[model samples]
Target: MMNDCSLVVGGSKGIGLEIAKLFSERGDVTYILSRNKGKWLGNHIEADLSNERNLNHVLHYIRNNKIRFKYIVFAQKNRSLPDDLDYELMIQLKSVKILVEGIAPSMEGGAFVFIGSPSGRFIVREQPLGYHLSKAALEHLTKYYAVNLGKFGIRFNCILPGTVLKESNREFYQANEDVSNLLKRITPLRMFGEAMDIVNAVDFFSSEKSRYITGQVIFIDGGQSLEGQESLARRLTFGED
Candidate 1:
């Protein structure tokens, strides 16, 4: 029997936790994994996603409960330095691959939503190079999986969010006024996004609303990625102040 269950990795806080909360509110059997337990009143599985043994424990629980996920969200992040690229790749890539292998058999007809970043598609030299490179690789991996797993009725897509203003990171943004100005000035929307925006996108992908969509990368970046010399050229041509 197919169950209304979801597995949210790296969901203890930030965007992932918000998505998990949405799932739980809708009465879905949600499972969350992160270093710390979130404030939600649902199941929170403690596991270091980068550690094989820890992930094994999580796999065991899923197998024991016979929980088949209808939605799988990979919201994991690794903000380590360039020197720690190996650990970052392990957590953001290898771990996700392992989780998919472990649970994909039960994911027939389900949707896989990867919480990627705008860095995946565009060149971002300001941030850690490792971070940008890993996400780029992840985007390709999403396409590869989408093609291979389509036969099993599984759909894969990526949500590339940019400059999301979450409550947890309010202080960081407030302290970095220059960065905040750059984000606002570059984005066509002239504003930063909220966590709920991404959650809403995920909801659509996970439901029948997007049944025909697969192997797509949706950017929720408020048009920030649409800026650069092209934007300047357009302004010069149109004389828009």
Candidate 2:
């Protein structure tokens, strides 16, 4: 019921869609920018993150429409590893950077949430190198903006999700029984998180409830990052022995 305008990038599926749904349900003017129009019957702007011109168009559309944003969420998901570094960075980081810079000026002290990964903070060898690198850089960039843009009262933060079960990832988690079991076993919660879990985090940050928090990287990963670091340390210790 709050008067807010939100722009959700990559809102076609997975985490982005869930975030957009939350905004729509709350009666916010939610604009989804994605290449594919999701089944969600809400406002949508079809734009490819890899295309800078498309991103620029979205920025102009928002500006021309005078959409003053209260929340901006970057929830783009990279399911596959790309061979080209430029393409990978473009999708994962560059496009988001442009959108944030473009829209930040119009924000009235709102929050910008980036859906990041645990791989960004830690060394996760099993993940695609390009994705890991891009996320790591994205996380750093999140902090950079937080420092630079705090004067304007725009909050920038990142949420590092663990294995959040989504329609897109259901099949992969089902197929990789070993990986799923290992993830559950290591996590203190002993269960994979659902999309709602992440949406809740975004909801908090987007509201005045978290007005004082910014430049922080919060992990909603059920302690998976801690477990991963512990496992890595143990491996190193055992190798020396």
Candidate 3:
């Protein structure tokens, strides 16, 4: 009998890394696929998803090893070229499509959770247009795969996170007291979410608890999405009511 296998794409750092850690802690045979090696308790496959050759190599390695993934997470983001449409599309959407198609055949039954952004539906001025487009498309991709792959007992879902603090942006958020406090005030939960919050949602989706759930888009934003944009903006500009 083999232990359950899990794959975390772009798991080298931040929320992705936290998700990988969760799987490893639960005794899953975890694999981290990223351009750089992550400091985590798992097998690290250093490959750039944007490179066609690297993508092929990753698929081949998984197949050759007969690794059957029970949970797959897509957390890859193109931070280097924020304004490049092609780069954003390739990392956020194309890579997910290719990897899922390649791995779905071997998966017995499991879930694929996409780490998307609230900007998928809402506009974040700080982010580029390409980022918004790619994220919006990713939501549909999740649903598309869910509908087609249901016969294989594989579930697909997307998670849209808002203002979640992680390793990469923790210092920035901690230092910016005004912005941080404003975000908390606008959120219905009155708090900023942590990386573990997203991890918990991923864990739920991958576990038997969500066995009957599929094609769902969950927002792990500490209820930030509940507030209207105008209201949020007013709060940001006027320092709350």
lDDT of each: 0.84, 0.85, 0.88
Best by TM-score: 3
As a whole number from 0 to 100, the lDDT of residue 193 in candidate 2 is: 95
- Model 1 misplaced stretches (Cα beyond 4 Å): 1-3, 79-82, 172-182, 233-239
How does model 2 score by TM-score? Answer: 0.89
> How do the residues 86-142 of candidate 1 rate in per-residue lDDT, one tens digit apiece?
787888888889888888887658899999877777777765766777899889988
Per-residue alpha-carbon lDDT of model 2 for 117-174, expressed as tens digits? 8888777776667788899988888899999999999898899988789887889989
Residue 4, model 2, lDDT? 89
What's the lDDT for residue 142 in model 2?
Answer: 83
Q: Cα RMSD for candidate 2?
A: 3.5
Candidate 2 clashes between residue pairs 3 or more apart in a chain or in different chains: none
C-alpha RMSD of candidate 1: 2.6
Question: By lDDT, who's the top model here?
Answer: 3
Q: List the RMSD of every prediction in angstroms.
A: 2.6, 3.5, 2.0
Q: C-alpha displacement of 4 in model 1, angstroms? A: 0.8
